[model samples]
Target chain A: MKLTIIGVGLIGGSIALKLREKHFVDYIYGVDYSEQHLREAKELEIIDEASPLENAVKNSDLIIVAIPVDSAKKNLESVLALINDQQTVMDVGSTKSGIVQAANLHKNRNRFVAFHPMWGTENSGPKSAISDSFTGRAGVICDKEDSAPDALKMVEQVAEHLEMNLLYMDAESHDVHTAYISHISHITSYALANTVLEKEREEDTIFQLASSGFSSTVRLAKSHPEMWVPIFRQNKENVLDVLNEHITQLRKFKSALEKDNYEYLEELIRNANKIRGILK
Target chain B: MKLTIIGVGLIGGSIALKLREKHFVDYIYGVDYSEQHLREAKELEIIDEASPLENAVKNSDLIIVAIPVDSAKKNLESVLALINDQQTVMDVGSTKSGIVQAANLHKNRNRFVAFHPMWGTENSGPKSAISDSFTGRAGVICDKEDSAPDALKMVEQVAEHLEMNLLYMDAESHDVHTAYISHISHITSYALANTVLEKEREEDTIFQLASSGFSSTVRLAKSHPEMWVPIFRQNKENVLDVLNEHITQLRKFKSALEKDNYEYLEELIRNANKIRGILK
Candidate 1:
């Protein structure tokens, strides 16, 4: 299959790299607003060629939208405008509703499948891409029923080729679930990094002591705001709901410590330990 | 040399296991209040024998107090009371102030070293012990001037054998820094885990959407309360201070989203992105 990856950065680059490694695609056309990223993608050999978005979309069998969510919504509309009946266009944005809505009235709406491959690293760009990054991760397909059977099946086959477990959900529920599981993690991480950065002036002390639990907990603070701001903006209500709940939880922990209610604090931590069942 | 590890759980058992792997100790005495932990420690070969506290302390050349900070402060007093001039004692507690103060006026005060090794896993107990766990990590030794040259040197040598970078600071500073770097991470994680567990009642949704980022961010929430609660209690004031700052940061993020202030949210994440310099 000929694959075209728009915004060939971390997620897109990883998909290109992995799919190419497995010979799932005979050729990959890289498209990006950033010329440097396109050059790097080609130089890293993450894609076979760098092509303009229109040209890439026109020439490829599958076009993957991997830009920021807001941009992705616009680009998906653009891609749907140009794709023929045989071509499939899908997005791998974190937010789903915006993109799905953008294509709802499109003539080729059935050709577009809203996808979110649930995998990433702290790093970004083509250089950060690695082989088999999405293996064993859950790939969420939102509003699958809205898309044509063949279009959905093609994406499912690609996902299976990538070794991901397929999760079917609507766009609204996808946004809500991601707000809790994924987006809020980045928010907490940003808050955590800022918390330590604001108070702990001695960076070396933090560097020395941070490798324990702090590193893992604050790892997502290094995530690119370009990708996340659009996500948080697009899924504002869901993100706000989870963010509000997260703050409330933090306040409870704060009060527990302020009141010297070590028992209550212990209970909170013990309750939090239950995440082990869901996580590990 | 003979080694006695009191409270042979994760930290203690890991130390004993590593020392045994390095052939640094001829015999290791496992001393724990829990008989079950002692039996597990013995079976795991983290200790050469399970013995009573006094018997273990008196028979060893070096004794490591590897319990929670509150327990370590009390146990450090008991261990110091029984140790001779030639024997060296060190406590691997997260907080150093309480442990340091407990031995401040003792005749064997110079014989005890305050140590905090900056490495741990979310898992606990002797079964969780692994060789070379401390390698390439920082080992903070508080109040080196207060310890005898020989005693400090002995513990420093053990740290070197474990391949840890020895960091010397006072007890108060160590506790404050650790609260900012380590304890606050756990608090953030616990709060985050609780927030998701509260809002996302469909545990399956979280399990499906959670990937590396969420897992890493919430991994510390799986930490044992028995180990963390006492550390939080002993370092109550410092923990509260950092927890307040973390909550404040979270509130800023919440408010930014609520107000549709994406620029401020962007700035927060950008500032958080600066942690890339410190972490990676």
Candidate 2:
């Protein structure tokens, strides 16, 4: 199969590397608005060639939209305008509702399958791409029934080849779940980083005392703002709902600590410990 | 050197294993109120023998108090009563203020050097101990000037054997810096884990959508609460201050998203991105 991955940065470039390594694709083409990224992707061997978006879309058997969420909607709309019944279109954006709604009215909407592979690192760009990036991670396919059977099967085949577990949900449900599990984590990390950086003016102290726990909690703060700001904006309502609840939880902990309610604080931590079951 | 480790759990047991493997100690003695942990520590070969606290302290040349922060104070107080000028004593607690303050007026104060290694994992107990855990991590030694020269030299030798960087700071400074960097991260993680676990009731959805970002952000939540609760209690004021600032930052982000202020949100994230520099 010939695959054309749009916005060949971290996610797209990683997928290209994996597909080529697994012998799942004969050739990989890349499309990027940034000429620098396109050149970097080629230099990194993430794609065999770089071409215009239209040229890549028209020639490839599979087209992957792996840009930021808002840009993904625009690109998906354009792909929907040009795609035929035979070529499969898929997106690996964090937000699903906007992209799904944007492509809903297209005549070739059946050719598009919305997917979110639950795997990423704090780094980005073509330089950060690694082979086998999505192995053993969950690949969520939203509203699989809306896509053509061949399109769905082709995406599932790629997922299986990459050793991913396939999960299905509606677009709205996908957005809601991601807001709680994934999106909120980024916001909290960014906020926590800002909190420490703002209040702890003594940068030397932060560097000196930073333990493994602090490093783990603040790891997500290093994520690219360009990638996450649009995600929070696109999924505004769900993100807001969870953000409010998170703040409320923090306030409760603060008050409990202030009142020296050790028992209540212990119970709260015990409840949080339940996450161990779900994580592993 | 004969070494005795009080509280034969994660930190204590790991130290014993590393010292034993390196042949730095002739015999390693374990002392814990919990008989089960002592047995487990012996079974895991973290310690050569299990004995009563006083017996272990008397027989060993070096005594390492690695108990919970709350228990650390009383344990140090008792150990100070029994310790002589020849027996050097040290602690591996998270917070330093309480322990240092409690041991200040003791006759054997010069023999007790307060230290906390800036290394740990989310797991706990004897089973969680790793043989080479402290290598390459910073080991903060508080109020080294107060410790006798021989005692400080002995503790520095142990840090050298483990290949840990030894940093010296006063007790109050250590507690404040740790609260800003280490303690706040655990609180943020626990609150984040609870926020998601509470909002996303469906375990499957959380399991499917959880990316490396979410897992890394909440990784500290898997930490043992019995070990953490006392640390929080010991560092209550500073933790609360950082917690308040963290909540304020999150609220700023929440309002930004609520009003769709993408520019402000982007700038906030850009500021958070500066942490990458310090962390790396």
Candidate 3:
């Protein structure tokens, strides 16, 4: 199949590379607002050619909208407007509710599948893309009933080619779950980074003394604001709910320390240790 | 040299294994409150023999107190009281000020060197120990001026054999710096894990959707309370200070999300990106 990858950056570029490796797509046309990214995508062989959106959508059998959530919503509408009934348009966005809702009113809504692949690194752009990045990660198809069988099947096949475990959920639930599991992590990391930056003036100390634990906990702080601001903005209410709970939990630790309640502090850490069983 | 490692758990077992690998110690005596741990250490070949505290200390030239901060404070004093001028004692504790102060009142205070190896994993026990865990990490010697020159030199040689970069700082400063760089990371991670566990009752949803970023941020939550609670207790004031700053930072994100202040949110994230330069 001829694939058109819109916003050919990390996720889009990765999908293109993986699909091509699996022989799932014969050609990939890269479309992006950034000319440099498009050029890089082509030069890196992440895509076969760089083409205008209208031209790429006209020639391709599938179009994947892989951009920031805010951009993906409008881009999905535009891509859907240009595609025929047989040409499927799917999005790999972090926030699904807004984009899915945006596509609901479109004329070719049935041709669009709302999907999210739960895998990412702190890096961005085509150069950071890896063909096997999504292997064994969850590829969520939100509100699958909203899409036609053919459109959903094609996206499922694409997820299979990327070596992902397929999951189905409603868009709203996906947003809520992601707010707790994914979005809050980024917010905490960013805040933790800011906390250290503000309190620890000596950068050399942080460089020399940072253990793997500190590095792991703050790693996501390196993620770009361009991608994250929209995620927090789009999932504001859910993110805020989780963020409020997170602050409350942190305050509990602060209170425990202030009161010298070692028992309570130990209780809290022991509770957190329950995650070991879940994650491992 | 003969060496005795008090508390034959992760840090102690790891140190014994590495020092043995580097031929720093020809004979190892594993001493711990738990007989099972001593037996495991012997069986794992992390130590050559399991001995009582007095017997181990009398026979060994170097003794490492690798217990929790609270226990290490007492253990250091006891081991110092047992050692002579030729026998040196060192500790590998997360917090420094309390333990260093504990040793200060002892008659053999000058024989004890306060040290911290800046590395750890969430796992615990002799089984969790790895010989090369401290390689390329910082080995901090706190209040080195208070230690006898020969004692300090012996611990420095141990750090060298472990392949660690050596840094010298006072105990007070080490506690404050660690509260920012290390302790706060553990507290944040534990609080984050609690936040997810409290908010997302559906464990399967979390398991399915948790990405590498989420896992990384919460990984330290798995750290044993036996190890972390005393670190927090000893560095309570500094940890509380950093924790307050961290919560304040998190609240800023909350306010920005609540007020739809995307610009401020973007600014917070961009500032956090500064840590990338410091860490990488």
Candidate 4:
């Protein structure tokens, strides 16, 4: 298949490389607004050529719209408008509801597949792309029924080639679940980093004494603002819902600690420990 | 030299194993309140023998009070009462102010060294012991002047053998710094895990959708409450202070998201990204 990846950055570049490595993609065309990213993608051999968005779309069998959620929502609609019925289009945004809803009434709606392969790091850009980015992680296909069977099959093949376990859910449910599990983690980490930075002005002390635990918990704080600020904004309601609950939990802990109620704090921690059984 | 580890749990057990592996000690005596732990320590070869607290302290050239912070404060007192001037004593508790205060006016006060090694995992017990547990991490020796020069030298020897970088600070500062850097991380993790569990009732959804980011942030929540509850109790003031600051930060993110203030959200995340420089 001739694959064209719009916004050839981390997610798009990784998929293009993985698909090519597996011999599933005959040729990959990269389309990125940033001249630097387009050049880097080609230089890194993530794509066979860097082409204009219109030229990339006209010549490719499969088009992958991989970008930030807010941008992806706008680009997905524009891409859908230009793609023929035979050419399959897909997006790998962290969010699904916005992009999916944006294309709800598109003429070639069935040609588009909405996928979110649930794996990422605090890093971004083409340099951060790696071949095994999707291995052993969940690849979510949102609202599969809305897509043509051929479009869905192509995405399924991509997921299989990358060794991801494919899961199907509607866009609404996908948004809610990800807000519960993924997006809130980044927000919490960012807040935590800010908290430590604000309260402890001596960076050297925090640097020397920080355990592996502190580093891991604050790891997401290093994520790029260009990606996360939009995510929090796009998924505002769901993010706010979880953030409110998270704040309530934190306040409960604060109250218990303030009251010297070690028993209450102990109970909260014990309840939290149940996540071990749930997660691992 | 003869070495005695009074609490054969994670920190103490790992120290015994690492020291034994390095051939730093002629013999190790394991002392614990739990008979099962003593047996496990011997079974794991973490110690040459499981002996009574008094017997262990009486025979060993160096005694390590590797117990809970609250318990270490009491045990340090009684152990100092039993030890001769030639016998050196040190502790591996998370907090130092309480332990240091308990040994304040003891006749053998000079014999005890206060140390808190900056490494741990969610797992515990003698079975969790491993070689090189403290390698490349900071091992703090608090209030070095309060300890006799010989006693400080013995603890310094153990740190070198375990390949830990020894850092020195007064007990009060150590307690305050740890609360900001280490203790607060665990509390935030526990609260985050509880928030997810309380709001997201479907355990399977949380399990399947949770990314590495979520898992990393909440990993410390699985810490054994027996170990953490006491630390929080003993360091209540500092822990509470950090928790309050953390909550305030959380509220800032919550307010931004609720009000659809992307600019404020962006600023908060940008500030958070500063941790990247500090941590790395």
Scored by DockQ, the top model is 3
TM-score for each predicted model, relative to the true structure: 0.98, 0.98, 0.99, 0.98
For candidate 4, the share of real interface contacts preserved is 0.85
lDDT of 1 by residue, B1-280 (tens): 9999998988999999888888889899999888999999988888989998999999999999988777788778788889899999998988888888889978899999989889999988888887789999999999999999999999999898889998999999988998889999988898899999999899888887798899999999999888888888888899888888888898898888889999999999999999999987
Q: Per-residue lDDT for B1-280 in model 4, tens only?
A: 8999999988899999888888889799999989999999998999999998899899999999888788888778889989999999998999888888888879899998888889999998988988778898988999999889988999999999989888999999988888888898898899889989988898888888888888999999999888898898888899888888888999999888888888888999999999999999
**Candidate 1 residue pairs in clash (backbone atoms < 3 Å):** none
The models' CA-based lDDT, in order, is 0.90, 0.90, 0.93, 0.89
| The TM-score obtained for chain B of candidate 2 when compared with the true chain B | 0.98
Interface root-mean-square deviation (Å) of every model: 1.0, 1.0, 0.6, 0.9
Please count the clashing residue pairs in each candidate, in the order shown.
Answer: 0, 0, 0, 0
Q: lDDT tens digits, residues A136-200, model 1?
A: 99999999989989999989988988899999999999998999999999999999999999999
Instruction: List, for all models, the DockQ compared with the true complex.
Output: 0.85, 0.84, 0.92, 0.85
TM-score of chain B of 3: 0.99
Q: Which stretches of candidate 2 lie over 4 Å from their true place?
A: none
Off by over 4 Å in 3: none
Candidate 2, position B119, lDDT: 92
